[model samples]
Target: MLDKLRREFTLITFGLSGVVLLIALVMTFVSNVTMQNNVTLSLLNRGLEVGHALNPQMGSKDREGTVGADSMLTVSVDVTPSGIVLNKSESPVGLDEDALDEIVAKAVSGSETSGTNWARHLAWAKKSTVYGLRIAICDTYSRDVSLIRQGISGVIIFLMSLCALYAVSRALANRSIKPVSEAWDAQRRFISDASHELKTPLAVILANVQILQRSKDMSAEDMRWVGRTADEAEHMKGLVEDLLTLARADEAKAGSVGAAGPMVELDLSEIVDECALEFDAVAFERGCTISCETEPEVMVTGDKQQLERVMNTLVDNATKYAAKDSEVKLSARRDGKKAHVTVNNKGAVIDAEDLAHLFDRFYRTDKARSREETGGFGLGLAIAKSIVDAHGGKIWATSDAASGTTFHVTL
Candidate 1:
């Protein structure tokens, strides 16, 4: 149980951390891409403006409008029909001869003439002229790409930080479950000790009441009081035993199941059938019937007496709660590698909210309260859960207006 709780804690911590960090990383990358696109588009627009400023047909106003919009150096070259360059204008920082040759060759050959060089942070663009010629333009934008590179670096660092946080989160998750695990262990120990301490007093009280009832000197009224004391002491004894059983189950080691010598291989199908038959008579007295459907040879490794108690408790509860003249069904079958037992009664539907606490210790639902004559201490299901846990199994309940209530167990 402690291991299961620890695993749950680890998953919750790491799962939340991963989801939150991933979202932050995605937002950061998205914003970074947006900013980079804006910067790149600005560089391309500046190159286009420079190209338009040197356009042959541009009026003076167009040139004036283009001025001061972009201060990046640019060169415009026209490639003629014979693939010879007609240099139109050169910026103060003119393109190197090799670079000019590369751009002219691409434009004249009708290939893509717009791109950037990583080594120099230069951007280039080209446009075709009317007489089978082309004008190519190039410029430098080192500062803009440099800023983008730094922004990308920051994103990388952010991603690395998330990794570190994930690692730390796992460590914290381990530590976070420690106090809860320790407190739970302490609770189990306390219950075990208290139950053990109460057993002797309860036994002594019951023995004394039995002695008082047997004495010829006692009147009928005195005998009645002794009987009541005996009955109440027995009831308290059962409660103490239940608490001790649960404490023992909880104290089972993390992975060393079946370590206790008391458990043996049990025929689950036989137990269910016997409980159903036993309860059939009880149900018949209450104007109800028990119908059993058990698969042959269904088996589990568990304490037979404890498992029998679980089945008996479930059958008794079902028989008690089933509506008059309604049917209570008990079933046992092998489901995959596990044994499944189900007890279903046609009766009052348990509320959705009550179903959640149905197995909780001392929890009586509103419907259970209505049948006070057949009152229970409300620890039967809880004891069954502890036994199921000891056997490495699961138990749950479901209900609805149409189907009544069903208690299901897997072993």
Candidate 2:
């Protein structure tokens, strides 16, 4: 249960954190692009300033002075349509005639536009008049590229922070569930203690009723009353025993802390067959029938008594609620590395919501009907689940209008 809590907390926290991180990443990318566009336009405008100086008809001169523009530009080469270098700007490091011709060929053959090649540390912008020479501005987008690198580093930092946050959330989740785990353990211990205290009195009462039943001279009315008392006592005994089973199962699950019982190999097929036969008479009395299709010698490792209780609980539950004149079937089969046992009964379909909680302790679908007609505390399936869990197995129930209700066990 603590592990389950930890996993649930981790999933929920990480899911929310993922959304937040995604939003942060998106916002960072948008802001980076905005910054890049602003800076690129600034650089391109500077190039346009220098080009306008050469051709007064191109556009109006820039309001921002070109004082520091030359330092930023390595070479502003002018090339003709036939790829002749007409002019080259004054710079400390200038492009060779070969490089200028190559760039001019590509620019003239391609669309007239501004572009940046961060890989080769170059930026180029072109302006052309119809049937005239093409003047191009070329430089490096060092500032814009630096901004992009910063964005990349921010993304890496976000991922690392997310991982660190996840680790912290898990640690907090463990601490948060510790009190709940303690309270749950205490509740189980109390139930086991209370059930033990009640057992002696229940046994004494049952023994006295049996003694009274043996009196030959008793009147019919007295006998009936004694029979009723015995019946009630037996019912109480069953409930107390179930509570004890659950308590011990808890202990067993808590690191095998001196469990009340141990598991051993048992023929599951034989167990199912015997249980079906044992309940056949009861089913007949209730206008129901029992049918079993058990695979012989199908074995499992489990406690014989607890497994028998599981069978008894399932069969008795089926006999009580199964539609009159309908049949209940028990079957055992081997499925891969495990064994499967199923009990099916024809009955009204259970609602999906109620079906989900059918195995929860004290959660009955029809409380009044179960109390008056079925006479159970709604712990049968819960006990069965605990037993199966202890045996490293699983148990669940499913129902539908077409197939009736079925309880399946995998061991």
By lDDT, who's the top model here? 2
User: Which regions of candidate 2 are displaced past 4 Å?
Assistant: 52-64, 67-77, 81-85, 88-112, 116-123, 130-152, 216-219, 256-260, 294-299
Report the alpha-carbon TM-score of model 1 versus the true structure: 0.73
lDDT of each: 0.74, 0.79
Best by TM-score: 2
Report the Cα lDDT for candidate 1: 0.74
lDDT (tens digit, per residue) of candidate 1 on 1-411: 566766677677767776777687677767766775455556455544455345433232344364332434555555677668755553554567777776666666757646666565555666667544545454545555656676677678767866786677767866887798788878878998999999999889988888898899988988888898888788889889888877776676544234234777889999998888777778999889999999999988888888988899898988888999999999999899999999999898988898889888888886435323755678888888877877778999999888889999999
- What does candidate 2's lDDT look like per residue over 318-362, in tens digits? 988899999999999999989999999999888899989998988
List the candidate 1 regions with Cα displacement exceeding 4 Å.
1-20, 52-163, 174-179, 253-264, 367-372
Error of 1 at 180 (Å): 4.0
RMSD of each: 6.7, 4.4
